[model samples]
Target chain A: MVDIVIPPLGEVEEVRVVRWLHEVGDEVQAGEAVAEVECEKTTFVIEAPVGGRLFAILVPEGRVAAPGEVIGKIAERAGGR
Target chain B: MREVFWIPLGRVGYREVLERQRRLHELRRLNKVPDLVLSLEHNPVITLGRSADPRHILADPLALEAAGVEVVTVERGGDVTYHGPGQLVLYPILNLRGWQRSIKWYIRALEEVMLKVAASYGIQAKRVPSRPGIWVGNEKLGAVGVYVRGWITMHGLALNVDLVPDGFRWIVPCGIHGAGTTSIATLVGREISMAEVSARVRAAFAEVFGVQVRVRDPTGLEVMAR
Candidate 1:
C-alpha cells in the first residue's frame, strides 16, 4: 500500500486544484490519467500509479496542495468468499 | 554518419520525444540493436512530471510562444522544467536491465554521476533526504527526472552546467516554487564549456552505472535508445 505524492519539477511554490478526474470508488490503472491541475495553467494530466480501488479525494477539487503531499491512497480489499 | 551520429533538432519536444522512445521500446522488446544516444539542443521547452499539473507553470504559454519557445507537456515524472539550447539534453535508450532495473536505485546512481561530474569542475553537490536529486546549498545544481518502463529509462536529468539560470525562472523547476537552482559554472564563478560537462557526465555515468561507455552519434541514437 504505497501512497502517491507529488514530485518536484521547476516549481518552488504551491498549486490550486483545478479539477479531479476520478471519484471515490473509481477504479484506476497504473499510468492511467487521473487528475488535472493548473501548474500556473499549463493544464496537464496526472496519472495513477498501481491499479486498485481509489479512495475518495483527500484534497478535493479547487483545493491547493503543496509538493510531496499525499493526494490519495490505494488499499487492497480483504476476503474472498 | 558512419562512425557517429549528430542530430541538431534546433528546438522541438517533451512528450513527443517520449512517444518516439516508446515506438523504439516495442522494437527493443523484440531484441533489436536500439543502442543509441542523443544530445539535443532545444529552443526552450517546458515538461510536466508524472504527478504534476500544467497550472504549476508560472509562465504564460502565449508569452513563451511569443518568445519563439515551444511549450511541451511531457510524460516523465517530476514537475515543470525548462530545456533550451544551452542545456545539453542526453537521452540514453540503453537497457537499464544492463544497469539495475530498480527505478529508485537507478535515480540514485544518476545522482552519483551528476555529483561526480560537478566535482570534476570544482563544484560540490549533494542529494536531499527523502527527496531525490542533486543540490548545491539548497539550490538544485542538477535535476534527475526520468520515465522507466519495464526497467528501460527515458528522459534523463537536467544539469545546469553553463545554462543561464534565469531560463528556469520561467517555470516552477521540478514543481517547487521559489526554490532556486544552481549550475556548475555558477559555482566556480566562471563559464565552463558544454563539451567539458558532457565529457565528465559521460565518464561519470559509465563509472557510476558500471557499463562500457559507447559513444554513438545522433543518427544512431534512434535505434540505439530502442
Candidate 2:
C-alpha cells in the first residue's frame, strides 16, 4: 500500500483540491496525474507515485488539502495491474 | 540578475493566446527559449478556472453567445473571471526552477508588480488579508490565475486598465459578491493609454521580480494571452 499526499507548494500553507482525475478502484499508472490542486497562483496536477489501483480518496473536490496530508491511498501493483 | 524577454503582443483573442502559451511552455521546459514575459490585451471572453463554480456565471448561455463572447474552461487556478479589450494582461513564462519555487512567493511578486504600478499612478493598491490579487480600496484592480507545468508558469494576472466593468456583471467576478471591479482609468478619473500602462507594468515587473526587461521581437508568431 502507498499513500498519495499533497506535494509542498512553496510558501503556500494549503491548497484546494480542484478535482480528482482518478477515483477509488480506478487503475492509475505511475507518473499519471491523479488529482489537481490549486495554490495561490496556479492549479497543478499531482501525479501518481506508483502504478496501482486507487484504494481510497481522503480529499474530494473543493476541499482544502495541507501539504504532506495524505489525499488518497493506492495499492501498488506488481509487474502490471 | 537574469533578464526576462519582454514580448509585447499587442491585442489578440484569448484562445489564440492560450495556444501560444502552451507552445512557449513546451519550449521553456526544454530550455529552447529564455524566460519570457508576454504583455498584451485580450478580446472579450469569460474563462472558468479549475475550481470555478458554474453558478458564478450569471449570464444566460444564449445571451452570452449572441454577444459574441466566448466562454472557455481553462486549467488555471481561481474562479470565474472576465477579460476584454482595454485590460492589460501579463503572462510570464518563467522557469522558477532555481528561484523560490513557492507558489505563494510567485503570486505575491506578481501582485507587488501591479501594486507598484498602481502606486506610481498615485493609486493606493494593496493585497487584502487573504485574497490573492491587488485591490484599490474595496474594489479589485487586478485578478491573478496561473498554471505551472514543471516549474514553468503560464496563464497569469490581468489588471483592469480602461475597460468598462459592465462585462464583469455577466459573471460573479472571482466568486466575490457585492464588491465591484475597478480599473486604473476609473480610479484615476482619466483615460490611461494602454501603451503607458504597459510600460509601467514592465518596469514594475522588473522591480518586483528583480529582473531586467529587455524588449525583443518575439521569435514566433504573435502570441496572445490574458
For every model in order, the TM-score on chain A comes to 0.80, 0.93
True-contact fraction per candidate equals: 0.00, 0.87
Checking candidate 2 for backbone clashes, the offending pairs are A10-B102, B17-B224
Q: Top model by TM-score, which number?
A: 2
Task: Return the number of clashes found in candidate 2.
Answer: 2
* lDDT by residue for model 1 (A1-81), tens: 546555442343565555577887887777665665434222334566667767757787768777677777755344200
TM-score of each: 0.68, 0.90
lDDT of 2 by residue, B4-62 (tens): 88999888999998998988887887787889888998888999998789999999999
Model 1, position B132: C-alpha lDDT score: 67
What digit string (tens of lDDT, one per residue) describes model 2 on residues A1-81?
889988777867888888899779999998788998998758877878889999999989889889989999899999633
Compared with the true structure, what per-residue lDDT tens digits does model 1 show for residues B1-226? 1121223343346556567666655555455654444556555677766556677778788888787666765556566788875676766555666655445566677788888988887777888874567888779887766654444556677677777535788877777766788777778988788777777777776677666665544456454544
Per-residue error (Å), model 1, residue A44: 18
Question: After best superposition, candidate 1 residue B30: deviation in angstroms?
Answer: 2.9
Scored by lDDT, model 1 comes in at 0.64
